[model samples]
Target: MLRAIVKQGLRASSRLAVNRNPDTSSYVQQLEAEWETAKPFSELPGPTRWQIFRGFQKGGQYHQLGMDEVMRLYRKQFGDICLIPGLFGMPSTIFTFNEATFQRIYRTEGQWPVREGAEPVLHYRKNRKDEFFKDCVGLFSNGPQWGKLRSAVNPVLMQHRNVAIYLKPMQRVNRQFINRIRELRDKDSAEVPADFLSTVNHLTFESVATVALDEELGLLREVNQPPGARKLFKNIEVFMDSFFILGMKPSIYKYFPTPTYKRFSQASDEIFDTCSMYVNKAIERIERKTAQGSTKDEKSVLEQLLQIDRKFAIVLAMDMLMGGVDTTSTAIVGLLLSLAKNPEKQQILRKEILGKLPSTDRDFSLEDMKSLPYLRAFIKESMRVYPVIIGNVRSAGTDVVLYGYRVPKGTHLLMVNSFLLKDEHLFPRAEEFLPERWLRQKDGNEDSANVLINNSLNPFVYLPFGFGPRMCVGKRIVDLELELTVANLVRNFHIEYDYPTETTFKTTFLYKPNFPLKFKFTDVKY
Candidate 1:
């Protein structure tokens, strides 16, 4: 049937072209036939054909698309799951605006796995050289290895009771970030040290450095980045680019030697070489903890992990650093951009903060962060709009039927989050930045107040931090940081938009506010 269509396209092309060279005409004939065949796929309403096809295209797409742009493309091309093209390879079916589809994937990661082909492994190994990353983290392992590390690591995050232990270090780090912003504001220039990516890159790495290792990188305070700090982040950026962006379709290199393949190998080395330093440092810290008889009350992340097994804990500690940096930094950048675009919302959040704390007084306390309702809502809303991971990718391991589409074993499957976050079925005026959307409840499970698109509040749609057992283990830390940071800044300073209403947003990994916005640190008017 496919051959017949191709032959028919050849006949059609022969009639259309004035001078037909066989190679030229044959390629056109092939592409035209593919388009014609793929056109029917858009008509299939289920996720089967549409979701898979869009997965491939999205796999191929590497733009710095903000959440809005990504959703717009997904909707415009809804439910086209096959990879064959139309209008020069662009799909017409936007992804189904299905938040339940989002729910299905988020709630079901055991059903879907992150195991990419060996080509992607090269990239992962390059950026994460730690033995535990190579062997332990759920990101790398599948069954027992994933279960073991996940079991050990997740408890650390789940027990928010323990976060109180982290409070003192986090206060020092958050102050560094706010002070860095203040220093930039004082700078007398237009560009005035923009690039929120670079800013967040420093903060998160420093957080993990202190929280995990009890070391101060001082990235926020340093006039220049500390040794290995800048390089490690650059390697992270490269690894992300090589994996998500220009690095798709790497299977071709599995069979042949090519320039692109060579570059991938080189990048893999640079990423690994840079990451090794951190891992080695982690090992040293774990040993030091053992020598010093560190207890839970006195332990850093490395110290606690060392209780498990020294080497294992060291690698796992490094794993925490690698995993923690990109996700939270991406999120903070997203929150800042959303705040910039929604000045009214930012002011509302600030009020929630100021209402709680009469003044900065001395500095932020963890207890002060909890009561800021709108502040939390503002961060939740931003995460909804410009999520970092966008959602997990899974492999079916065996043949399965999803919504009646035949999904064979070994096919890469995507479950999209950006599509659902803006699904009109889930929220009103889906694309607008309305933090208030998170504040209401439906049939009255008032505890769902913190839930995004709370069905009790709006249809159960929130996966920026992911859902269920495999959901992000670092969520509590991120939440604590966000609520604390925003509350402290707003309590002490008047942070307002300095950039024009237009083009306040930029994307690279996630949305970001143009800096030089000068979150002016004024003494609170008591």
Candidate 2:
């Protein structure tokens, strides 16, 4: 089909050239020469179709391998550019590890960029019997529909002022999270449970809910917890687990509802219903507050979004709850592990934190957050070393050339950025946990301790939140939550992980922790 399109395009171009002026004809001839010289898409290096199919089977080479490891293997076998044949209703994907290719792809992605992953969620939303999401498909959607929603919510979510409104509320939640960590640790060991990721999940959920639902869920507190909060948290876990299975692996869930799809559908329904209930309650509260003229100085994220449209607000809230929890939790865990492993780095971060606040009891103001360059750099370095997502995936908005190959429009391009983020060429001493690498040099001079990353790093290679218009919508919220949590954590305790650091994360839709997180937290004296 693609070859037919190429041939048809060439014939049309040839016909138009006969009626063109000399300059136009020369330009057309030059374009044709470039196209003819470029290698065909089929000649791109990768596994054969049969190999890809068999490797994904029960006992094949790619079986049971995390997506991160598989991407690494592909790079090792096929070098920078590789073609992954389409299998089991999935589209053919092109994986590129070259930094220039990454830049070219983003440059051409134009307005209304099409990101083609999230098929399972898209299918569920489109085929719902109730048609609940017929109008607003939220962030996972593409083209005009995604653009509309993104534009509507940008004022409430994307702006620094709007996102800063949640700082105080989120700080309260962070305080509770710090206290919960103290309570959860063993008295003798001063270490949290092996399943410490669950605790971090609660913190992320509570933080997101504080902004999204305009109320505290009390998830991190020991007593007086909301009854539905636990159930909502569990349902989100099930939703993420099922999404990983359906999204990453090959299956016939779209034709006939598989067990995983069934679980996914049920979890989706429950999550939507619960979020709807909370949002509706928030609507009523806002209405009453408006009626009595008793609103606060700052509005919650939900309230600001509701002014746009109710249904849009509900869908956006649900998307936030679903997308925010697992990704942020994984990131928090990764950052904590990075700090725990490098005790010297952790101490440096603590000194930075203490110089600003002097006490854990004080809340983090916006000004204080801006001043902590090391804390910000530490987060960036941690994510560089341990990115939560494998890479960014996008479909070609139009026909384009990539790495001397003619890639047709609609081909799914997976920018395998994980390899580039840690590559020695892109980052100096990439393997080491050095926060100073991201810190900007002062007095127009470079020091041995600090690596000037701006001169060496490609802007496109280190995309933790992604790039351009289709980037993560909740990036601001996630950044604030992470910064607040890490600051309060370093100021309050000495984080330590007394174990060998080997194989820490596995890619399950998102890169999640593979092993137990038993981090020891000794109280720090100010």
Best by lDDT: 2
lDDT of 1 by residue, 68-120 (tens): 46545654664534222222222222233344434433222342244432235
Can you tell me which runs of candidate 1 are displaced by over 4 Å?
A: 1-97, 104-119, 122-138, 186-192, 246-296, 397-400, 408-410, 440-460, 498-526
Candidate 2 lDDT by residue in tens digits, 1-526: 3233324534443444333323355644654566688989878999887998799899999998988888889999998899988766877789998988887677666556788878989999999999988877888898766766676676688899986789989999998888899899999999999998888999999998988888889888888878788878888899889988887777789889999999999988888888888998998998899899999898888988777677877788778888999999889989999889999999999999999999776898999999999999999989988888888888876566788888877889999888777777667677888887777666654532345364656789889998877788899999999999999999999999998769888886588887878999999985
lDDT (Cα, 0-100) at 402 in candidate 2: 83
Can you list the residue pairs that collide in candidate 2? none
lDDT of 2 at 271: 85
Q: Could you give me the TM-score of model 1 versus the true structure?
A: 0.71
TM-score of every candidate: 0.71, 0.92
TM-score of 2: 0.92
